[model samples]
Target: MRIDLHTHSTRSDGTDAPGDLVRKAKLEGLDAIALTDHDATEGWDEAQAAADEVGLRLIRGIEISTQFEGLSVHLLGYEFDPTHEPLVQELGRVLGGRNDRLPRLLDKLAGLGMPLTEQDVLAGARDAAAWGRPHVADAMIAKGYIKDRDEAFRDWLVPGKPAYVGRYSADLFEAVRLVCQAGGKPVIAHAWARDSGTKITPELLAELTEAGLAGLEIDHPDHDARDRAALAAIADDLGLAKTGSSDHHGTGKGPAFHLGANLTDPAELERLLA
Candidate 1:
């Protein structure tokens, strides 16, 4: 099966609606796709319904915001029950931290004289705190705050950049345990990039593997072939499953990546299903 295991929808930072994403996957000849929305499983119902319509298999998933050693560690949860309460509670905690920290970020920016506000981000957000910088970037772009997301992050959004806020209270090990309790396999998202810095060391990988990490996202838009090779080797040495995908988020993301373009095959889907 043509499976794109990693992707987003408006339920998180992605521009497409849940059902629309399924339709787009169908158009791209994808046999299976996972609705790995960031920090929430709210899109699964709509995604499943849409997948039914398009005859595409929708793997229920979530991209959780977690941490290890004060660095952001995005955990991908796959093949879990949507109604799983433990997962629900933990996601709520993670997102609640997200909500709380974002405002603190706004407050920090204001103190720094940037004058950015949560209201600015919320106006563009589809709902609650499920979205982040992208919405702010779009609003900034719309209001001419910055040229695009790249400029937005470089100028105002990325960590250590002006107007950035730190998100604390993210316990990555607990997130892995929660996904395991929810019957989902948790995978560490894109590492080996300059952005991750010291976060992707062998020791860190070992710690996460011991903490119940099931896989590593070796294929991604940011990872070069050499990086992927290093990650794949690490996954093998550590006995973690190796996975790949284009983290598609519609037109908002740059070119050369979209649904099914860079994908994990059916065999991997079968492995995930198992």
Candidate 2:
């Protein structure tokens, strides 16, 4: 009954293909895995087919980029109707933003004396639905400008860095409502990570619960013990399902993000999908 509820594939920032990610998850002893590619549902069918072939349960999901109080927040939506018009339209805008920012990102990098063509970045994107920072990082890696995604972000791509470029993101509250409207369960992904948790107070959590937030991700590689404890308590108070996941990004992330490094309890999975 082991389930890891968040991961990515070549459809987004992760290195693995949809089917490869599924096969790897099966080999890692995961009974269930969710393909939560960033803002895209293109990987769902392929991942689902692979999961079926491997005798694994697949939870179709997306890790939507959203903004809350001027901070970036990721929302995980599961089992949604991918064709829901409004949701689909919103995803299109997000993907468009990702694509639209590529040239600007490259321009910034070129200004910093590291010129790259769109083809260079696209070469790393593979089957990705859109271009993103990770693909840019991969391009940088290819140019030997950085060793990995970590160094790339630390030096150039992250906010306040020279290569940083702003992009459109959905409003968090609206995103939650949209996911619910699309017949999906919406959960905050790694709610306590990257100092975003400091803004998600109990009062805000209560408000989001009313706004159709179904769960909170409590176990993640980025969350320490204290953060998990506090988030768990808040989730308990709000009657929200508590989720755990590896947040696997294939080789795009560190070893701590290995598949099934963190897992959701079966009962919690039931609660989340209820």
Q: Indicate which candidate wins on lDDT.
A: 2
**Among these predicted structures, which one has the highest TM-score?**
2
- For each candidate, what TM-score against the reference? 0.91, 0.98
In model 1, where do residues sit more than 4 Å from their true spots? Answer: 107-119
> How does model 2 score by TM-score?
0.98
When summed lDDT is taken over every stretch of 10 residues in candidate 1, the lowest stretch is 124-133
Q: Which pairs clash (backbone N, Cα, C closer than 3 Å) in model 1?
A: none
lDDT of 2 by residue, 1-274 (tens): 9999999999999999999999999999999999999999999999989998999999999999999878788999999899999999999999999999999989999999999999999999999999999999999999988899989887778777778999999999999999999999999988778634355677877998999999999999989999899999999999999999999998899899999999999999998899
Whole-model Cα lDDT of every candidate shown, in order: 0.78, 0.93
Tens-digit per-residue lDDT, 77-97, candidate 1: 898775778777777777776
